[model samples]
Target: MSIRQPVSVKFILTEQTKQQILTEQRRQIEQLTAEMDQIEQQGKLALEQAMTQGGSAAQEVRQQIEQERNQRMEQREQLIQQIQQIQQIQQLELGTELQNMTVETMVDVNVGDDWGMVLMGSEIIIKDGIVHEIRRGGQPV
Candidate 1:
């Protein structure tokens, strides 16, 4: 039997091949740089257009938003004033109701209690059946 040997080959670059590869790499880099520059220029143009053409629109929107906020604040203030007026009316009604009640006596429930029974004058103020402010002997208590 006869044995055959296979041939092995090695590749090497000459100066021309090396220069060709470098030129291709430089061309690719230049192409990519040109593409990036074009994209940046387009972005700048778009931004300038938006700032110039849409400026008045943006200002109008901002003014509308501010006006709405002021309106809401005014409404809230009016509502708060109405609530205060209502509370004042309620207090007056409570005072009138208390004035109608008559206290028969001011007896001390406990003999040695620190808080003795309070004496009510001719006029008194009450809310929810609880005495809040009172006048004793024509003086506020």
Candidate 2:
């Protein structure tokens, strides 16, 4: 990616941070999917009610329901785009192991090591005086 204006940063790479970001993005995607499903159910219920009523009022309600469903579909599409963006960021993060030294910032960040980047919305935790344990994450092959 390209930065609008270049600024130097130092970044630290960690497995936990990557997983956290992926989890959050997945949560948002799930939430959006649920909302879309709800919208479909609501539209169906409205149409069903209008059908049972059967008249000019029913016609008007049907038209309104169709309009509302269209709007909800648009919202779902936007949510899908958001999920794609998150996936793109995830891939970018995985491609490079950011450790230290200087490089122009690709995006906004709250980096905590000599810091090339932590990207926006990421945090680095500091434990108060204890044994620091660093090891590989995930299951054994």
Candidate 3:
């Protein structure tokens, strides 16, 4: 039988990787800022229209817009924090491994298989967009 397993993907810190991460983070920040601005403009127009129609309706619309704005603000803050963390990572010595993401793979299972080893999971170390090493149970494979 075949079983699915989760594996961790880690990155070995390098100058190139650091800059790539920073670029992506900054792009996300820009997108969020643009979205926030768009929301403000659209909300203001809608609110004004509602106000002309009814005061109570306008108040409700304003609340909804505020809620959406708050959500965007929180997301922006988180992205900023991630950018800061990436900057800190740059200060670490090269080859320092940081968990980047996760992926799934399939493994063939048979009777009497070592469950401990099979379930121990795996990790792939990447450097400069290439696979540097693969480890299973903390041992290079």
Candidate 4:
């Protein structure tokens, strides 16, 4: 997997791609919700027409309306799930806290090396996302 660190190691997260996708999804849900009202109206009209026709026709229309409502509910649930997933991904993407250094803005990158060292007041040895060892000034790594 790619870590998505900054190329200059002096940047922060400012990408709007994920956010933009989330916005689009929200817009879609809104549109679907608006359309759901129309679906309900159509179902009502179909049922009323069937009632005038009597017997099996009315029953069939009822079943069809129920099925259509179920389908719309399922679609709404799926949209809700997708929105939740996108929110989770966005949170995970923003979760990294770089306490030692601050980068104003950055991009996603893959660090090929397994181990890295940063010399502050101490020699900080890091592997993966964990700080393994911190040797103070004048101490060997």
How many clashes show up per model?
A: 0, 7, 0, 7
Question: What TM-scores do the predictions have?
Answer: 0.29, 0.44, 0.88, 0.53
Task: Please give, for residues 4-49, the per-residue lDDT of candidate 1 as tens digits.
Answer: 2221121123344334434554565555555555545664555566
| lDDT at position 125, candidate 1 | 52
Candidate 3 residue spans exceeding 4 A from truth:
111-114
lDDT of 3: 0.92
Q: Give the poorly placed runs of model 1, Cα more than 4 Å off.
A: 1-53, 94-141
Q: Write model 4 residue lDDT over 1-141, tens digit each, in one string.
A: 333332112112224545665888889888778777887899889889999999799899888878877887788889899899777667754434223352332222346532342222333443333555544332544
| Ranking of models by lDDT | 3, 4, 2, 1
Better of 1 and 4 by lDDT: 4
Off by over 4 Å in 4: 1-14, 94-141
**Clashing pairs in model 1, backbone N/Cα/C closer than 3 A:** none
Please report how far candidate 3 places residue 13 from its true position, in Å: 0.9
Candidate 3 C-alpha error for residue 37, in Å: 0.9
Residue-by-residue lDDT tens digits, candidate 2, 43-131: 77876887787877678876776776677667667767866765665666432434323334344334353233323212222222221
lDDT of 4 at 37: 83
* C-alpha lDDT of residue 25 in model 3: 95
Query: What is the per-residue lDDT of model 3 for residues 37-96, given as tens digits with 9 covering 90 to 100?
Result: 999999999999999999999999999999999999999999999988988987889878
User: Evaluated with lDDT, which candidate comes out highest?
Assistant: 3
